[model samples]
Target: MSRHRRQRGGPTFARAATLLQITKLVEFPAVFLSSIVQANVLPSRQYGQLVVDLSIAFIAATVMSLGVEESLQRALAANPRDRAIWTEALASRAFVGLALTLLAGILLVCDQTSLAIVGCIVVANSIYDLVVAQTASLLRPAVPSIFNIAAVIAASSATLLVRPSSSISCLTITLIFSSLRTAGCVLLSCRLLKPVRLSFRDAVRMPNLADRGWRPLVDLTVYRLTNNILNRQGDLIIAGIVAVDKTSVGTYALAFSLTTAANTVFLTGIGSMTLTRFSATYAESGKFELGKSWQRMTYLTAFLSSWPLAILIAIGPGLSVILFHGKYPGLALYLVLIGVVAWLGRISGGGANIAVLFTLRNEKLVRKVFLMAAAMNVATDFVLMPLIGMYGAIVGTMIGTFFSSRFLNVQIRRRTRSSVEWSPLLLLSCLTAIVTAPVALLHRSFTLSICAVVVSLCLWATFSWRSSICPPEISSRVHDVFGKKSSVGTD
Candidate 1:
């Protein structure tokens, strides 16, 4: 019976992991579509204002979250039946949500109507995000993802139908759709996942963090918040300081959204698979196998992400015009510059550290690295944005990512005493250079650019295969396809 259980465990885990990956990847299209529709349909100023409001709401949600979601996931993983902890987390979240709501109400008196509406949705989404996080930790992520997909479709359809003509109308529609999505997430959490429902009694009881230690919770929360500020909050930063003109903000937002599509669909979704594999590998062999696993995962992610990113940097301008209806001039150039910065950010973004540290349960180290990185980000943004306009934010993001990646390396070495190899990134950079240089040297001919990309990808694949960086399955298939040719040619 035990043997059967072990056999079943492998397949079951794989299935669940696959589902989660699919969920994230599938969610991307709906999200990207919604952004596209919103960008095209709304007037430029309205869309820019909407981005600013949403950004503020997200910041509020991050604060009000109070790190409970991360703490809850860890606590539940340690003791799944610990109802007290679950209740405590739920109660804390409820209180924070209420406080935020009250603050939002006060904003109405202050005439910050847009922010107030956004605050309501933020509160709802924060709870919903917590539930989804819980479900993912419970290894049944598909349930919430299903509800998320439904909500997105419904929201997008409604937004499109309404075609909000003004900023206020758009904000109202956004609030309504966001609330509906939250409701769907909550219902699915209760019905499908059978979450521990927290009563008013449970909602008020605070946990004693002194006894259990709040280090992990604080580390993860600060890391996530700071990371978001650096990477994902560019539109907000532009709205606040970098670009005062709504059209400029709107243009940057549109281009950034396009880059996010690449991240969501390809880079991030695929990256999660490595985290799962690393966790299992560490559990089985501890630090002995972790170094190699980390290296392989990093190389694999670099290989997978390099081409699409290079493609984006190469063809982003033309693609932007075609996709977004050419509302903003110079958008293509903005897309290219942002795409390069984003790709650099993605490659050097320290997924290996995240996977390894989380596996080692060294949350404190992770937190410290991110905190420093966040500081670097803030300082860089302030200096650069004042000097270089919107490009300053992009440059700051790139530099901030470099700092974070460097600190992550330092932590990994202190713990494992092993150095991570840079050959993979060097190789990827070489490939990108090969692909993009010709396009820059030659005049803007779409056909030549496409040929350069295809040829560069072929070269990259061949080089990776020769270097043994290609996965075993792909290598095997390649050998089978080419083996007969080599033998026949020799004859």
Candidate 2:
């Protein structure tokens, strides 16, 4: 029976992951192109301010969320037809949005239009996040992914048409598109599930609506808040506080943006799918199946992430020069440092660990790990930023990522009592480092960089195919694509 269940679950999970990846592939280029346009059109200082505002808005949205989105996702995964949970979560988000709108109005009345704009953005982002979470929990991420892609393309086209010259103008355009995105998501979700009438009363009654108990919800909220702050906006916030000028902040922001783009394109989809699938697996089959799922996702994420890191290392310098007109100094080094941090986190199985822990309902441990890492990240930034400037932020993030990821892996191993097969991850990491090192040295040579990327990817593919580093299903699929037979066995 267990084997039968595994066989049934594997294909469903793979199809979902594949759909999400296709969505990201469509969305990433639009987002990357938009960043390039903004960087070229806006002055460095203005772009820096723009980055600061967006960061603040996102951080604020996470705070306002109160972790309800994630809590709802977990709940829905276990009980997908739970209408009460869905209604309460929607009401909570609506209430938060209303409060932010009121705050925006007050800010505008006080003549703080810049802050007002940010307040509005916070509302839009928060609502969008909740709606997307709702769809993802229902195991239908493609719906929101499609709308999100549309939003990005529309916003980018509008930006190109208007060609905003200042931070405020750019932000205003962003707010407009962001609101539209939120509306589209909400509309789509309504079609999928019954639309609940939201009121301030439901918001006031949210505490009492914790049908599963409040402690878990609160713990999840806290964990998510800290994790979001550390991962999303920590460096920029610290850089803004410690840097001498906005240009430095903007430079770091641009570098981080490129790394983030890579992450969004390659990892975000799989990570989301992993959480939902892991939650379902845990509910149905317990930790044994959960451990198997984690190993598969870890290997898959590492393999997919390696391609972007290789490309970035090989051609990032020339790409930066062409895209940003060589305006941002030290861009290449920042890319490599931040990119390594992301790659390290993946190979360390950080994302899979978090998903597994969440599925196991170990929120308190996750919260503690994230809080400690957040503190370390902030402390490192404060101590090093004044002395070393932007590099301090990069180093701080690297330290925080390393510690949190390693700690989480240890906890996961203890709880599951399942040993991780690290050979594949180690092999991939070593090969990636070796092949990309020469390209990094010759990053200035565009021809060599291009050739190196092709060579590196071919090597990765050949080695992975021969050694069966990829998950068995993936390997077999590749075999089918090439009209060959796979000798790989199922887990």
Candidate 3:
């Protein structure tokens, strides 16, 4: 009945879940700092520039990373000793990071904002990857989130004082500094590996050539590439099509920043546990229960996300008006959508993605999937944005994600002889849709808030009744999450 214990899985789940919760706690700081940034520091022009910079940087970092971060995750089984990964991962990252930094500097000098942004993102992200890989090798999830929070707090404090008008430069500088901080923290925390000093011997021990997971690496690479294009391409589009207004850009960036904060919930809680569960589940029962567990997890996410999302969509306008000083006038509407996006991320199947990312040989299809989706996403954005604005980019994103999931699901079926339960998904989707309607349309925050409470109570009661009748096999797991607070499935 432990929260970390699934029907089957290793002891690592406890560490993983704890790490996730710790990471989730960091979201509080991230969100809080972002609000401050939007309210006081980031103007439209500065914010817009940050987006352009991030979009470019993210793409570069992703390319240079070449799925190495994921490779670390996928290769956990083969390299359980966690020896050479740090050295090799760091060296590889260093090479990519330097190249990208130089490239960004050149682009900046040449006045190519987008290209410079991309290069900056790449270098910054590479530092982040190296830190993350080392942390994971230490097999300590909490370390990563802890590093993340510390780094953010430090960066925000430094940047807030300077409060530079140029967000792009400030952001890039903070990122580099933060990455260094994270690396130091992660290295220090790795008591298990007893990390030898970074030297010739460390370099020799950290092998760059891991042969086991190239196939899965390809899959992961492609998936991330396409997903990023879908999610991060907006800055480019905004810069190109819009009037290059910084305030407009800043408002949107602030909204997206908030969204990123919101999405951390899924990353820490769902993604962390789901990945751990997959490791355990595959080891325990092949793929049979994976599908069922996936369905159940998806349902739980649907319910959990719905209430907060409803509140956001309902009260968002009022909150924005009061809190933001029209810095981001209608940001609440976008925030609601962002919450939906965050919640939808839960369905991306942590296990399947991990399995595919680790494959050294069978990853060709995954690469193809990424390339095709990226192409299609760009095409959709190109076609849609002129007509529909930012939502057009979202459309492109939806198309790409739908394809990715369908592709992953196909692989899932072939591997495990299991299928997604479309019926329940559809049912919940419909219920969420109906429940979300009043919040979207009803402007009165108090009324909507009251309605939301009533609806949540009703839904919980119904879910509780269903669980009693069916008798959840994983009822014990509920005790761990709720502890003495309360659990839905348990009597």
Candidate 4:
């Protein structure tokens, strides 16, 4: 049954995956440029505060969203023409947004942070998330890309144009940029699905969703919030506990931003597609027979994620020195370590687990795993950050990810009990070590190490083609692209 299903729908799935990858590629340059601007233009102290405020806004927005972005996507993907789902989801989302606004206002009064900027950023970013999901749910993967690309380009240009004197001013520009992107995405989403006449008043109205409908939102939100705390919000904890100055705080934040940019892109692209793909598969197959798909996607994610981190490790030092004018010394090493952590995140079964488990409606397991990891991360950060500083925080994040991945692997095994390949993951892990070992051991000449890593990856790819561990879809695509007639049977 699974074989027949794969034979019939594999090409469509492949195309969806490709379009999703293109979406990430489209967003990457703008996001990277924006990060560069944020890192370079501001004073360290101000940057640190900016990082804190931004993180707060992000977390608050996620909390406010109540996981509606993903929940809406999953629901809408199941019934794309369901206007009621759209109205109800948006209504609940707006209610949460209003509550968040009041909370942001209180925080603004107490902390003297720019509430207006944070508020705008939160609303805009959250709206964008929903609209992207909306578009993707309708199988218009490329439409979100158009809106996102335009917004990113506009934001990047505005960042250059405004030349804000203060961090607050810079943040205001950031908010405006996000708002522009949100506006574009919303407009596009609405235009593409015009039968569902959505309105502003509908956003504030009470959603008449059932308890089962709302449960997934809460579960997803918990996992997402905890995950964000582990990855993005930890910098604030580091700042409060260990940082003596704003520069140090900003340095840690910058290191995170630089190292995890690739991680964000890959996850955003892959994550956006997985739920829809998995749900659609279940709808067709009438069973959760997606172990092979999960394995293939996981391996593909590792392949897509590893090399960028390797290159970043290689070029980060020189780039940091040149870009920041030596403001962040030892940043290259930080980038290398953080990059490895990011690489581990991909191969260690984190992304696949989240997508698969969620699609399976195993939200209980997902929440438990993330909660456990989040707790460990927070504890590790508290214990280590003050003792060892920024490295400690990075270590804390790695440790949490490791725990999460390990738990996820165990859960996948227990649930699916299918023969999913792990050798590719093992090989990729070795490749990661090989790619980063030189920089870790000798601590010099990142360019040479980068060349070595690239050569090794090319050789790995050359050899991987002959191995059964490689995903058949990827191997076939490689052959087709290079004009080779090949039949790599799907395992």
Please report, in order, the local distance difference test score of every candidate based on alpha carbons: 0.60, 0.68, 0.52, 0.64
TM-score of each: 0.75, 0.84, 0.73, 0.82
How many clashes in each candidate?
2, 0, 18, 0
lDDT of 3 by residue, 1-491 (tens): 33333322333443454455455555456455544454333343344455565565565555665666555444443344445555454544554455556666667667765455345534553565345534542445455556666766765666556654554645554455445544654364344335544553443232323544455445656666666675755434444544444444455556666666554554444443344344445555555665555545544444445555555655666667766656665577667666566455444543345343233234666667767877777788778766655555566766776676567667756765655444544455456557656665665465675576567545643553454421242333454455644344422
| lDDT string, candidate 4, 1-491, tens digits | 54554454323555655665566666666556555544543334454565566566657766666665556656654654566666555454545545555554566567545544556556655666555644554445666677677777776676667653454555545555555665564455445336666566665443423446767667878888888777856556454545535455556666777666667664565666676666666666534467766777777777767776767765776667666678776677778778878777777666777877877788878888888888888888778777766777788889888889877877876776654566766775577667666664565465676676677678567656776556676788879989999777465
**Cα shift from native, residue 53, model 4 (Å):** 4.6
Q: Model 4, stretches more than 4 Å misplaced?
A: 1-11, 37-59, 80-125, 133-143, 198-214, 242-245, 286-288, 432-453
Q: By TM-score, is 1 or 2 better?
A: 2
Q: Write the per-residue lDDT of candidate 2 for residues 240-293, one digit (tens) a residue.
A: 566545556656666777787777776655766566668777888888878877
Model 1: per-residue Cα lDDT over 239-291, one tens digit each? 46544455555566666777766655545434434454555566556776777
lDDT score for residue 482 of model 3: 55
Ten contiguous residues with the weakest lDDT in model 1? 482-491
Ranking of candidates on lDDT, top first = 2, 4, 1, 3
Candidate 2 vs candidate 3, lDDT winner: 2
Regions of candidate 2 where Cα sits further than 4 Å from its true position: 1-11, 33-59, 81-126, 129-146, 193-212, 443-448, 485-491
